[model samples]
Target: MPRPVRRFHPLLFVSACAVVLAACASERTLTPEQYEQRLPALEARAEANPSNAAALRDLGEAYAQTGAYRQAENVLQRAEAAAPDDPKTLYYLGVSKEGLEQPDAALTVFARYRDLPPRSRFQQLMAGRHGWLLRALLRDELAALVAAEDSLTAEGVTEAIAVFPLTYQGQDSLYRPLGRGLSEMLTVDLASVEGLRVVERLRLQTLLDELALTQNAAFDAETVPRLGRLLRSGRVVGGVLDVQNEQLRTDVALWDWPSEPLPGLSSRQAGLAELFALEKEIVFDLLVQLGIELAPAEREALARVPTRDLQAFLAYSRGLLEEDAGRFVEAAAFYSQAVRLDPGFAEAAQKNQEAQAMAEVAGGVDMALAAPRRSARPPGGTSLVHNRLTLLNQNLGAHVVPGDEAREPTADVPLDPLGAEPIPDPPPPPAGGN
Candidate 1:
């Protein structure tokens, strides 16, 4: 007021302009219905400015939200063609294709989005959804294929062999020992089948860890080769598990693993399952991969396995390993722990029964050997049960009661009748570090 200062009003004017621009940009007043209504406006905008990829994409999304799939697809495809390198345009194209029930094409579009650089949150969400949809469509298709094949087999047309190995990389890592154990069990189960060989691949844990250490792992060559090797099988089966927000999202693939010559099932992704259903599909796919048809009873058996508590399953695996080695005493202990951990574990229950029985037999043998023998000068006329017990003790390599006049056996006598060999220590840690 003193000097009527007109000093630097320009700075205030610039600040006000920036605030107005930000407000305009921040506005999200469009509802879903409003978004749908905006499609005609966006389409007109795109027609006026033919090079405006943003307008084209917005129109596509609006159309998609309104269930105009054909129009959405047309607009999204045009946007994708115009901005061939834009991840957003490609993502919309994928979304539109999914709405159109053209999942295979949608998978391609989503795959492109996955490969794009500077991935945004929106892109990640789309990719995750796309991955889920692809697996579901693939599994449905494979189920149909398997049913058709079963009908053919019923007609005595061709003997179809399905080999499903839960082939994955990183099996050797501590982080994924359960996966390795499951893979080993699958291999062992399939090994007993005639006319089928489970194609095994090296566990990925070591390689991935090594790459992590070296910091030179590129996705293109490394990941591509691993995936290609998996798909090389006539019928390849695989799954991917990702941790998002403390939950696991799994994607399983069961289709032709083409080598030099692509197989009939190469083009389509088939056989998908999610979460708990995913585990069932994995076991089921393995049966199909091995050409072992699942009857209703066998299907029920497969369905009985647990999924959520991987820790309990690992404990069960340890029990099975001990049981297989004939360490009944140790196996019983492990199985007991497994049962305590998971009361509902059916496989553990079965193994625990066998282990307990064997443990009882072992205990009886030890007790008989540890029992005190009667004095050398025994009273006359021992009962038949005593005699039988005495004989049983001797048969089990325990010291027999001797008469007063009897002399002890020479030190060179081999007293052990069971001829048990010394138990070797577990095999040394695997080479190149366990």
Candidate 2:
């Protein structure tokens, strides 16, 4: 047995591994303009090495980016044949399918991309991009559905609605949870705004549960109308999900509950984080459609609350939110706390000052009368003049005769003795001589 043993060629094994890796790592980096300029070079490369899958894939991507879908398909198909199981070739083919508006076919390619090893940097990038595109497409479909719903004026219109995962082959359950989480987060964020209403997933799930409905189950159009009426929501959001290049892509859509013919909004994208962000944006637009007013305070709160190191700012936002909610006392407390945390936090300091002033004014008649009215009048208008005089008399009487109250002194709080002298009138306007 020892004498019959054979030796393997190390160099040959290394070469084979390198070729496989190259095929697996195949990606095109040419920008649209660069791709256009290098088309001739790519063509020459392909002509010189007809079996070079990488070159063919790159050329196909270049063609797809330039709107040459048919040519891209042809080139990508050849690449696929050349490297039957190569993820890179599969991804390029998917891109070509997308360019051709064949999303179903493209999804299959993206699915294969998702199954690649996570350590591949090329796969990572493609996965993220593919997920993003898929989510965007789903969002577009949703928007069309919403639009269809808006187009309907009838009191009773029915439509069927189903949402499911769209992964390559049958890997459906893997990314579905992310899709559901994203939908719920979006609904919650949007619903938190005043004058906006979003249908929460729990309610939807409950309804489905009551009916023993699964994602594959189809409800009648008339049933949708009834569901819409019960939910008090005219639109429904749904989507498909897939994995590409070890990344997840989701396509979400908003559609009319009973008339799902048109989409209200649709978007496809890669990565759960990006999909969540897009969902926020879509919800924001929906709020706008529902006539929700995002106040300046709300906007500022949102901008500041998400920052980890901005504790003072977060406290300030809490204060403002409380104030807007008519919890002035709580607002003052928050603002004061904020100022204590960061003495130089000017906005918080100012808010604290205003809240204190307001509190004093609310409790004391003198403070209430002393505070300036917010109006478009000149600084020392009639009311201000009267108030100033009243304050002067009260102070003077307090000093001269305790407990002897007097009407506020008119327009003349005594100035500092060294203050500039008042300028004399110009001879009484020259006695109106003009």
Candidate 3:
């Protein structure tokens, strides 16, 4: 008799493989001494052929590996100029940008790299890095992009803008709404301008998340340049809010999206009693500074305040801030508060419904971070599944949902010619079956 054969066990096999992979990841792949030794040869090759993009890119990677990000960036910039469309050059450039704590520039570089078509597996690796960047930069847009669609790819009608959260120099904690509230209101106002697209607030938070900024220190003059590059915004709006004698005074400033100031501040003072009108005033002034002229109807439309109740408006503002931070359930609660305070608050009601829907679609922010993005799959793969499901749902008809069946159209079968004309019984069965 043959000896009994041992059987394979899946649990043990999986455990062993996981242990090996974790060990590999935890271990250092390259020592500094090893990198230093390899750097000299690459530098010599790059110096010999200064215009050669491939040689320069390799040398730049070596520099970055050795923690010399300054040198890496300088060399990679030159390489990029030489090979404007090169994917590898773009990737290493992004790496150096990240090492230098310049996430905005890195994001911009990765965005360009993601659009390039790949020719090999290595090129696909570059595309994969782009996918990772997208998850970090545009969280809400991830699922849409994964579904083979991009909402941000539309051509520039005029210029893009990034609106930083408003700053409150006052010492009152209760006045916190002025910070996010005003900035969000400004974003809405500017977004209504025909030729301009305001960067979504969540995208700004994504940038802030990379910087690990506390809410208090997220935006300032020094950071605006990087923020602008990251959002690809040509203009940025920032403001300071202070209260004196029960009156609210706001100073709004426009920057050229990097560092330069546009012209002058757009200042407004309003009685706290009429605070609802201040947002519209600031919006109109900013529009003038950006050279956007709105028609009478458009201006009137933008002028409409969401709610007159200060507490309700503040709650809605808090909702926007929460939603931006990916706390949809909390945001919905905030919006619900606003709606309850002012039942006719249409904007707040709509936002409440939206937040609840998003909460259901995504359990939390972590899901959005790990959700499938467009670059994670082969082109058209996710979309194919989406399309097939859509077709299936449509074909099943409204009857599948327990609705009235009479509303849906029945299939149009061809006229039954055999039923109408019976061919005279097939000529008497061919004379008694021949």
Candidate 4:
């Protein structure tokens, strides 16, 4: 369905300011336009360079200004799909939807826009749009909370839990990349503990794709039960990430299927720079809540950090998220960073090579990123952001090898598994290599 047209201001057309959009493009000079004859040229520009996200955005804006709200919504969405998470793209999407009177959908995009970090170059615009939209939806916010509370039930259930991708619910979008990255890292770390049947990342992606749930569903409360039931999980373990002062805090909850509550909630806090240890703490607490007895080997693994090099881990986590989002070219950049940061990081190196190859293929990708840029690094940092207002952080654990289709937990942790046995590290690939 398309959003309806609410109003059209003819004088505000593309001729006024062509807004030849690009990332961080506030200074990009726009072509002067008269609202009277600007639409065709903007459309031609977008058609000529289908991969030019800035041009697409400008075209969408032109449509909105002309009162073609439905067309504006469709075009703006395409811009968003290509640019993924660009605040300008999202802002236009929100504006188009707002013009069509779909405040609910508009608010979602506005939230994503506002949640972006300080350096996104659109912070001022995001803040203004976010404030107005938030005020517009104030009444709906309370209604949503009340509805969610009323839907809750305390029905007892099995111990199985599926940790959905962790999300950044804070006020800035800088940490958004860590949302899925943390989930994947948790899955890897939790896999170290015996008896827990962590859902593989691929299978969850498959399910989400099949169900046609948008990425937003991972952050939606209403989707938790359906997601758990589909995966046959007793609870879905995922939660909000927030940074306050120098502290990074995560609140994990197990949303039992059928809207029940379980004894599966825990929180972990650490200095923004000390997130590697926090990952292990979350795993331990999850195991304890699930009644799993960890063997000594498992205990040891939990105590150990996945990697001592923080920069490599950060690069890997950024790659992890880009990969999950199907932005292979973007992912390749981060993976390349990881490999460069730690030349010994074989898994990252391999993934980087693969992503670079895949991205360059004639797949349905925009030409901008399709051409491999091995030296590029996605938007993120090797060091922790010290801003008292925000931060983005994630640590890499073991690289996951592919597994069989995910299934329910059929058994408990047995004694003397990897946890009980002293797992020996392989001798550094036989000096020169294996």
Best by TM-score: 3
Clashes within 3 Å, all models in order? 16, 54, 0, 7
| Cα TM-score of candidate 4 | 0.45
TM-scores of all predicted structures:
0.34, 0.31, 0.48, 0.45
State the lDDT of candidate 3 residue by residue for 22-124, as single tens digits: 5324433344466577776667667667797766776776677677889989998988888776665676677678778776787688667446553322233
Of the two candidates 2 and 3, the one with more favorable TM-score, higher being better, is: 3
Taken over the whole model, the C-alpha lDDT of each candidate is 0.42, 0.46, 0.58, 0.53
TM-score of 3: 0.48
Query: What TM-score does model 1 achieve against the real structure?
Result: 0.34
Minimum summed lDDT over a 10-residue window in model 2 is located at 397-406
Task: Identify the candidate with maximal lDDT.
Answer: 3
Candidate 3 ranges beyond 4 A from true positions: 1-158, 215-219, 258-264, 364-434
lDDT of 4 by residue, 268-362 (tens): 88876677778778877777766788778868867876454555666677777666556654565566556655667766765654444333321
Model 4 worst lDDT run, 10 consecutive residues:
383-392
- For residues 299-411, what per-residue lDDT tens digits would candidate 1 score against the true structure? 56656544244444555555554544444434444444455555665556555544433332222211211111111112333322223223322332111221211112111
Ten residues in a row with the worst lDDT in model 3?
Answer: 399-408
**Which has the higher TM-score value, candidate number 2 or candidate number 4?**
4
Which is better, 1 or 2, measured by lDDT? 2
Q: How far is candidate 4 from the true structure (C-alpha RMSD, Å)?
A: 21.9
Angstrom error of the Cα, residue 12, model 1: value is 56
lDDT score at residue 234, model 4, on the 0-100 scale: 64
